[model samples]
Target: MIALPFLKSAPPPLQGERLYLRPPQLSDYKAWATLRAQSRDFLVPWEPLWAVDDLERSAFRHRIRHYDEEAAAGTAYPFFLFRNTDSRLIGGITLGNIRRGVGQNGMIGYWVGEPFAGQGYMYEALRLIIPYAFTKLRLHRLEAACIPSNERSIRLLEKAGFQKEGLLRSYLKINGMWQNHLLFSLIEDDRWR
Candidate 1:
């Protein structure tokens, strides 16, 4: 559970013009469950198959504990995306699988509610998080993976300065099937050399 000395503390809420990213809370279950339920069809194709009780409050409580432990261990930071205009929950994102020392790398994963998708909310969130990844988290590289058919996510990563790296065959089990994924990465400026 060792981590770089700098990231010993948990990060604060990251604020953007329209949204703010903060750690998930138990109280967020209702809003989060509602959004996920409403966006089930929209999200399932890109995500792992949901368990039978995926949207249940008890499951969400477990998630909150995992998030807390990961954050405390400096291994990952999970965030619930909330719209500032109405303070409504819109989505979530995480910087997970963090590696420190010489690597200083991590993986980014995210999803937006259906009604909030297609717009630039995720893009803005990415813009905000990437810098935080490099600065606050002191990471040198950030990676993301998406299925080949997910053009929107690929485009979003490209827009956020991630370079297409290569393809990973049967990289992850998604939506009840093993899916190939395209890898993309961004490296911090001074570390690029």
Candidate 2:
């Protein structure tokens, strides 16, 4: 198991020019529920099927507990994105399923509220997390997979310097169905190339 230095406390917020990322807090339930509720139509296609009480405060509390456990285990870092100017909750991003030792890699995933979509916020979030993963976390590679139909995600990953790897057949269940995903990856060496 990897030795996580921040096990005692959550990592400090990551700052960007116009956005910031910090771990989810219980107090954020209202904002989080509002955003997810408002963006449900936009997000449903790419995400897993939402439970009946997905937006409920109790469900969010459970999600937070799961996030805390993952972070403590050094297997995931979950964050909520907030606009620096207005402090509005805009989206979320995660570096999850981490593999330590020889693997030294993790998976990247994200979602932007509909209002914040197409505005470059997710890209900025990616820029911040990439360095945090590669440098602070000492990870050697980062991977992301998106449904083949997700053009925006493809563009985002490509713009962030991830190269298309291959197709993952029936890779994940999204919206109640198994879907194929295109794999993309960036190695530490790619950063310096």
Candidate 3:
């Protein structure tokens, strides 16, 4: 694949009090799979339908390749969130839709493991990723989309300084159906504006 406009870019490693962001690795498959499976009930309403044996090694290998390709191309960084003390994979997040030049913008997407939820891991992940976007990628804006009913995610984004812009009606087919989202964003200037 051709490189993204921000081809020189790469995801910066980020760390926080309880969480860290790192490139996803093959070793993470088992932990990631188990998290997803265990969180199925907790994640289904926010994600797609459970695919057939998606946790299998073959599928995971494909995903690893995809993550590597996207990260190398600077189109996205499929990162794993880890609990700092034990360095255990607790979730996945990505910075995508990178636009360079004047816009210098990107979007953040993430999912936290069920057991890790409500413990502020997602919030810490956002805290780390947003700064990485602004400083390392030199991004001017960062965006996030969350289902209106996803109170936890909404709170996390808001806590990270993203302001709700508006609602996108039936904007995406999440969980196999059209879903509305509350669009939120933070601009670089907003940091000190």
Candidate 2's C-alpha runs over 4 A off are: 1-4
> TM-scores, in order shown?
0.94, 0.96, 0.91
Candidate 2's residue-wise lDDT over 1-193, tens digit each? Answer: 5456854456679999999999999999999999999999999999999999999999999999999889888889999999999999999999999988889999999999999999999999999999988888889999999999999999999999999999999999999999999999999989633
Best by lDDT: 2
Q: What is the C-alpha RMSD of each candidate to the true structure, in Å?
A: 2.4, 1.4, 2.7
Which is superior by TM-score, 1 or 2? 2
lDDT, candidate 1, 52-119, per-residue tens: 99999999999999888888888999988999999899999999999877898999999999999988
Per-residue lDDT of 57 in model 2:
92
Q: How many backbone clashes does every candidate have?
A: 0, 0, 0
Instruction: Report how far residue 19 has shifted in candidate 1, in Å.
Output: 0.9
User: Top model by TM-score, which number?
Assistant: 2
